[model samples]
Target: MLAVKLPSKETIKVVEEPIPIPAKGEVLIKMKASALCRSDLHRYHGKVLFDETEEEANITPGHEPCGVVEKLGEGVTKVKKGDRVAIYLGLGCGICPDCLRGDVMLCKDFQCIGFQKNGAHADYMTIPEENCLLLPEKMDFITGALSTDVGGTLYTACKRLNLNGTQTAVIIGCGPMGSGGILMAKGFGAKVIAIDLDNKRLELAKELGADYLINPKEEDVLVKIKGITHNTGCDGAIVTAGGSTPLNIALNAIKKRGSVALIAESNKAQIDPSNQFIRTLNTLMGCWYFNRSDWEEIANFIVNHNIQLNKISSDTFSISEAEKAFPLFDSGKTQKVVFTWD
Candidate 1:
């Protein structure tokens, strides 16, 4: 079997590896589609922030993977062979309280698939049966792969904010996650303002139903958002791009008591609680992966509203072309790049 490996910075190597057999409580997935995410870029650059050792660099870099179950191990009853499923990124101790409740990402012993173990940027990968969610038959492989991460994460964030028709939301960044945020927010009936420096992504958001689009470089983001909200500020904001500027803009653009969800992977923000936080009584939170209920809701919403996940997809490549795929994705010139197998 051929698999993807990142042995050094800005490089993807396609290597021959033995096809993994399913272990007890696990199943072997025949790779179908594996979407590239911003998180994977960390591994592409040889940075493994999640684990203790540099040895974690050896893991294949892809977390948004979905495929058909090729084989099931003993004790694996959650899914059977030939079932199409999307692999949940987190692997956790099943008995833990968080795991039992389906918030496996919060488990103390959590291991992220792409960072801590071999992932789906390959011919085949094996994961615990409990981590495989059944993909809807109406969903294609590309959409199913994205539903596990970009769509799932944003959908979870929108759920937390309780966004609705009477409110307005400003989504910063307009990358895949930010774009997904726009879709989910609109699906929930909120008037969405899509913000990004990238015109292509902003255009995609417009087609996805964002009521307003702002490029911070072209127009003052705060001014435009305030004007759109009639100086009261938006009801909510989501920052999907890292940078103190976007986060601060989100904090300043929402109305009093408004909620801001931070999903970006940045820790360098300098915020003053006394001035920016306490006065408005605004709620700010860092959000990540979704719980099982949130995933189910996202799936239902996509089916019900006829959300087109592939609208954000840029291109597809085969496992053998991963060498070309990673650098293209790394360039920031494309969106939702994925690897597909026949």
Candidate 2:
């Protein structure tokens, strides 16, 4: 089998490796589709997020993986051979209360697959049977891979915001996650306004059915959003870009009593509690991964609405082309990039 390994900053190498064997209560998956996430960029630069004692970078970097089960180890009964599945990124202690509830990411001892362990970007990998979600028959590998993070996170946010046709929403980022949010907001009938600094992404947002597009670099975001809402304000906003500016924009642009979901992670921000939040009764939430139950709903929605998951990913490379794929994704010239194999 062949796999990708990042040994240093901005470097990717493909190496030959033996296929992994499943352990008790685990299943061996033959890789099919795996998408590159923005977080993976941190790994590319040799910044280790999970392990501190390790001297060299060794983990394969892909968390969004969809593949087919090839072998089932002892105690694995949830799925069988030949089953198509999407691997949940979180790996929590099985006995923990949060793990029992299927919110593995909440476990105090949880480990992210691509961060803490050898992940996809390999020809074969092993995971506990419990972490695999059965993919719908009609869903392709690309959509299956995306549903875990891109679709799941946005769907969870939409649920939190109570998005509907009667409301107007703003999405502050035109990356893959933001684009996915636009599709979800539109599917739920909300009028979506997408904001970004990049024109290419803004154009993609427009094509994805965003009612309006705003480039903050070119115009005052507050003025544009207010004008679009007829001097009122949006019913809700989602900030997917990591920064204080996007956070500030989301805070001031929504209508009174409206909600804002911050899906991005950032350390610095400016906010006025007395005026921008308290006076307006604004509801701001920090959203992370979705609940286990959200998977089925998200997949069904994608199928029923004919949401084109493939549109979010602009390019796909075989396992041998892993080196070429990373640089393209790193350049920010593409939305979602993936690796696939027969």
Candidate 3:
């Protein structure tokens, strides 16, 4: 088997290794497609996003992966050999309240694949049987991989906002996350307002079905959003841009009692609660990733709505090209970069 190893910051190597066998209650997935995420860059830069450790360089770094179950381990029944599935990144200690409810990402002992363990940037990887999310029959491997993070998070975020046809959703970033939001929110029949300082990202957002585009670099985002909503504030806002400014704009762009879901990775942010949400009776939620329970619905929604997940992918590379892939993705020159099998 071939695997990607980040020996150090900004270093990538494709190494040959013995194919791993699934352990009890686990399954071995034959890699088909894997998507690179911004978080993966932390590892690329020799930084750890979780517990401190010197073992930061060996773990493979592709989280969003879709593949076929080529083998099943002892006692595995959640999925059988040959099942088409996408890997759920979180490996939780089952029986906890959070894990029982399928919100494994929130488990107190959450071990994220690709970070804490070997991931799918290889020809094969092993995962607990329960983590296998069966893909919709008609869905492609690329789209299935995307449904894990980009699609699932966006769908869960929009659902949290209770978006619908009568409302407007202001997406405060036009990167892959925000672009995915355009697809999901539009599928829910809501009007979309795409905001980004980058014109290219905004244009991509528009192509993905944004009803309106606003470049905060050129105009007052609040003023433009007000105009689009006819002086009334938007019904909801999803902030994917990591910063206090974008968060504040999203908060103030919504109508009284409206909602905001923060999906970006921001450690600190400054905001006036009284003006942003306290007095307005607004709702704010920190949405991480989708619940394991939502995987079926998320996959179904993508298939049933004909969501174009690949439209957001700017590049694709084979695992052998990891050296080339990481640099380009780290450069922030692409929306989504994927690794695919022949």
> Best-fitting candidate, measured by lDDT?
3
Candidate 3 worst ten-residue window by lDDT: 52-61
Clashes of each: 0, 1, 0
Q: Say which candidate scores most in TM-score.
A: 3
lDDT of each: 0.87, 0.89, 0.91
The order by descending lDDT is: 3, 2, 1
Write candidate 1's Cα lDDT for 158-228 as tens digits.
98888999999999998888888888898889999999998988888899999999998899988898899
TM-score per model over all chains:
0.97, 0.97, 0.98
**Model 2, runs deviating above 4 Å:** none
Per-residue accuracy of model 3 over 201-298 as CA lDDT, tens digit each: 98898889999999988998888888888998999999999989999999999999999999999989999999877799999999999999988888
Q: How many collisions between residues are there in candidate 2?
A: 1
lDDT of 2 by residue, 276-329 (tens): 887888899988888776688888998888887779989999989988999899
